[model samples]
Target: MTGLSTLGRLAPLGAAVAAVAERLRPSVVTIENGSGAGAGVIWSADGLIITNDHVVPGDQARVRLGSQDVVPARVVGRDRLNDLAALRVPREGLPAAEVGDSRALRPGQLVLAMGHPLGLSHALTLGIVSALPTDDDERELIRADLALAPGNSGGPMVDAAGRVVGINAMVASPGLALAVPSHVVADFVTHIGEPAPWLGITALPVVLPPDLRRRVGVAAGLMITAVERGGPAEAAGLLPGDVIVAIAEEPVRHPRHLLEALARTPAGGDLDLVILRGGQGHRLRVAPARRAPQADVPPARSAA
Candidate 1:
């Protein structure tokens, strides 16, 4: 019968989903930080875990492993802007999640989310990729039409193959969730201890004139307001009032875009800056310096 045939075809899919969930449960962990509990993903065999910054705001927390074994975890690094934190546990040979290329993901792709929802452990949810970052978007987030709860933050969003493509960060709205892309997490892990690169300039977003916009191929850019004395921008002969159109070929339409581009560049690396001054487009090569550690100074509105 038609109904029987449909059920027969769906049986394999249901079995496959079960198998993937079983395989990935070991990599998902429950993190308790006194405020509440959330989930974390085992990122390495040597006990490196990744979770949301808000989950582990302090330097220490407890991680409940798949075996129900509770262990002490240390917050090794935190990137609050991206809402991601890296934790190290005193354990070895853990089952690590397979990281997938989020850049390869397309809208409508089937995805799975695993977490501890509402005190229930190892809960799984089904969903699909709803959208991706656009040129005007400020942050790189994976938007999903997935059901997520308070306890789902810091969990892994995997593809059908059980490879992690994103880290669930927050619920955007009803029936909508936003996740930090896996590629961005990889970059954060790579530069965990390194100081963020500094451009030594303050800037604000400004709309480009119609003729300049058509010529530059962008509608808006960051206008440099001040150049630090004897800094990279000064050394590169960059003056205030210059509009930054792009950095290393990546368009800069807002201050956040400039900050994101600078974060991607390594300290002491050469930056290819495309700028406009006096209605003329120019390219400048500036070597960014590593920002020195400072106290709780408020982040400047500029790119640095």
Candidate 2:
């Protein structure tokens, strides 16, 4: 979407993005729970702030609203599988990014990504969807070629309507960027009250040596790089090195398949994780945990 595309779809988009960023962006504090501080967008009013799960792994990350006020956020819920997470912000009625329909998303549709790229907080980037699902799971993807930087994790991607379409997740060497589709985010947010860390791990193309693929007799499929520490998979003893071969008995041909599996499951439920580790297969039943908000303050503040 054009920076103004969201403006085109929804008039007063400039005002809307501004307001949403003011409200939702404030709720999106920079996280330093080991993943480093970056931007996140508020998805709901009752403190359900959406961000990339990797940012706030622990319950003690810092949530700095607008300006410089920092607070402590606890883990309220998490979806490590889908890479979408919720954090609680102390301030109420924060501006929130509008959620748009990912199903209606068309390739080459104008899209925009807003986040802290290159450690520059609140920077905005533009790009097109570039591709779409071809019988593959749609809920798990938000592929684009827009510019992205390391610090842009957990930011929002908006449609012309200024509605959020995806959440920043990964970028490959060729500048291909991937995000969690808003619909997939909706599914995760819908089931946040679970007792365990229940998420479906999919295969990700981690940079394993080419020889590893040949030895494993697999060409290309998402590999399970790491599970959330002490999360449903961890609590269930699911290890980081394990590769997810399938979900619900369906072969996980790609990373997005894991997204489909997690979207289909309920919070507080057990998932049968089929994994390939050391060339051996195993099944593990895991329950996911609820995502949490981080509470922290800058060790020091500065004025530039």
Cα TM-score per model: 0.85, 0.61
In order, the Cα lDDT scores of the candidates are 0.88, 0.65
Query: Model 1's lDDT to the true fold?
Result: 0.88
lDDT of 1 by residue, 1-304 (tens): 9999999999998998999999999999999999999999999999899999889968999999999999999988877667889999999999999999999999999899999989989899988999997767666899999899988999999999999999999998988999999999998898777777876888877899898888768788889999999888999989999999988888888666876777767655788999999988899999888864222212235547
Best by TM-score: 1
Candidate 2 lDDT over 36-145, as tens digits, reads 67667777766567788777767656766656677666656766556666787676676666789887899988777777766677776667888765634423666888
lDDT of 2 at 304: 6
Q: Which window of 10 residues has the lowest lDDT sum in candidate 1? A: 292-301
In model 2, what lDDT does residue 155 have?
84
Cα lDDT, model 1, residue 186: 97
